[model samples]
Target chain A: MNVTIIGTGNVGQYLIRFFSKIENINLQICGRNSNVLHQFAVECECATVDSIKKIDTNADFTLLAVSDNAYKEVIEQMPNVKGIVIHTAGSVPLAVFGAKFNRCGVMYPLQTFSATRKSDFKNIPFCVEASDTDTLNKIHKLSKKLSKDVRFMNSEQRKVIHLAAVFACNFTNHMYSVAAKILESQHIPFAVFQALITETAKKACEMNPVLAQTGPAMRNDQSTIKSHLEILESNADLQKLYSFVSESIANFKKQEDIND
Target chain B: MNVTIIGTGNVGQYLIRFFSKIENINLQICGRNSNVLHQFAVECECATVDSIKKIDTNADFTLLAVSDNAYKEVIEQMPNVKGIVIHTAGSVPLAVFGAKFNRCGVMYPLQTFSATRKSDFKNIPFCVEASDTDTLNKIHKLSKKLSKDVRFMNSEQRKVIHLAAVFACNFTNHMYSVAAKILESQHIPFAVFQALITETAKKACEMNPVLAQTGPAMRNDQSTIKSHLEILESNADLQKLYSFVSESIANFKKQEDIND
Candidate 1:
């Protein structure tokens, strides 16, 4: 199958490299930056284009790997393609592509992608959403080639998943940043927290997070929690965060007790 | 060094097995429950003791791997001896041991220990803290036998590190539980989010979390954020958490720009 990928950013680059590895698949990578396009073309041994107009309409699939805000414009720019048009987005709806194409869907990889690291997509879950059965089947087949874990999810389901990810991944990382900042202010080395941070992740993987939850907040150890608040007293944002998350965990534990 | 682990819970069991694998180190496992101690002794090929009074104080080191609340009682029960007394605790202060013992310290492994899965302590940081240089050196040497990464940190530093870990690891996992609940409520499989969670953690490990942060909250995409809040309206606690974290991220990004 012939495939045209739009965008040469991290997501685009990773997808190009991933699709290039699959057998019997023709790939074309397009980006606004000619230099990036050329670099990717040279690296992945695939066709490179400077504009969406250059994308072959005869291709079996046109994958939009562009930013969510730029998605609508790129979809409009693609030459009246007869092939399936899909986007690699988590928040945006599939209907953004409209009903003009023969088939349209979303092939969202539920992982954070970076060009520097080789992503192991084989076990990564692919949330596939399509407008029709034929398009879904094609996307499914393509996803299977790259990953073993695939799921059919609607736009609403995908949005919820994305929101949860914001809390789980993005916000959680921000929490790390807050902790780092606090440590930095206190003249402590970041390495001091590295082991604890890693083990916390491992613990969550070992069991249900609710059960694995530990901390002054989770235990309702008011003395330590109060001391932590005092330490974070200067930063209003962190103080607010500390109070909010602590209360949330306490509430969760209380509800858990009720359920039990 | 001859070591006696005074708890047969996850941490105690894993530590016993780990110390057993190290040559020249004699390990004796103990717990209040004789049955559990017998099982650990048989399975791990170590001696067991039912009472703290039966502890071989002549051993090179005694590790109190019990719960935080039970720490005082356990320490009080142990027979007074000359060997180093170390506890594996993150929040509990070293001063808790009092000046009764000449050699007292902490050998806190900053990771969640599970008996089911073998942990590679090679990368796990061991935060060693003590009242004296000799005790600290001895603990450091002992930590080197288990992990390559060992650092001497004060009690205050370790406490802050523990707080940061709550944000990075514990809170992050709670976010996953929230995501799982959302998926479950919508009749969607929770496995769909596993890839995203793993990749997110891996991404943070590669880059500064500040640079890697992305989402509607980070972007300040009010519309999508609003939509997400609406979806979570049924969950008041979750809604509050979502708003608090999103606002915190926005505020943090603002501060970052100002600093830059």
Candidate 2:
């Protein structure tokens, strides 16, 4: 299959690297930035295009890996093609491609992408969505080649998935930042918490997260929570966060009790 | 050196397993549960005690790995003679041991403990706190045998360290739980978001978390945030949490911008 990827950012770069390794897939990398396009092309030994207008219509798949803001503009600029057009977005809808394209779908990889970090796509889940049965099958086949975990999901489903990702990945990491900042204020090294952080994450993965939950909030050790809040009192932001999250956890625990 | 582990919970089990592997240490495992004591003693080939009164003070090191509520009772029950008495707690103070014994300190392994899940202690940080220099050196040497990452910290420092850990690990995992719950409500498999969660965590570890922060909250995409809130509105607790955390991230981002 011939695959043309638009946008040479982290996502595009990673997809290029991943797809380049697939023996049967012929890859073409594209981005508005000529420098990045040339750079990725040189690195991957794949064809590079500066604009979507130059995308090959004969290609089997055209993947719009661009930013959410640039989706409509990029899709509008792409050459009139009969090949399947897919956007690798978690939040965007498939209908954005319009009825003009031969096929439209989403191949959203549920993972953070970065140029330097190599991801094991085989373990990562790819949420696939298509407007038609044939297009869906094609994307599903491609998804299976990359990962063992794949699911057929529509725009609405993808949106919920994206929201969940924000809570699990994005917000979780933000909490880490909050912790780091607190430690930084006290001149304590963040490395002190690395082991604890990693192990906590592994536990959540191993069991139901609710069961894995711990700390003062979960235990309802008001004394300890109060002491912690006192320590964080100087930082109003953290204080607010502490109260909010602690209350939420407490409420969840209470709900669990009632259910039981 | 003789080591008495005064709790047969997760930490106690790990310590027994760890110390049992080392040739020089004499292990004494104690717990209130007779069956648990018998099981650990038979499996680990160590001495077991059902009562705290059975604790031998002649040991080179006494590790109190009990729950917070049971710590004081266990400590009070220990025999008079002592070498080094240490507690594996994050919040408990070193001074709590007082000058009642010859040597007292802390050997807090900064990680979530679970019997089923085996952790590689080689890299996990052991925060060693001692009342005096000689005791500190002894604990540090013992820590070095198990882990490469060992640091001398005071009770005050450990308190802050625990607080930071709550945010980084415990709170972060809760965020993941919230994410999983959201996805579950939508009839989506939580496994689909694993890739994004893993990558996001890996990225935060690679760089400063604050710099790596992204999402509608960080971007101040109020429309997206509003939509997400609407999805979570039925769950009032979660909705409130979402709003508060989003607002906190926005404010933090603003502060970061100002600092820059």
**Clashing residue pairs found in predicted model 1:** none
DockQ of 2: 0.67
lDDT of 1 at B131: 75
Task: List the DockQ of the predictions in order.
Answer: 0.54, 0.67
* Candidate No. with top lDDT: 2
I-RMSD for candidate 1:
2.1
Residue A80 accuracy (lDDT) in model 1:
93
Q: Candidate 1, after superposition: displacement of residue A6 in Å?
A: 2.3
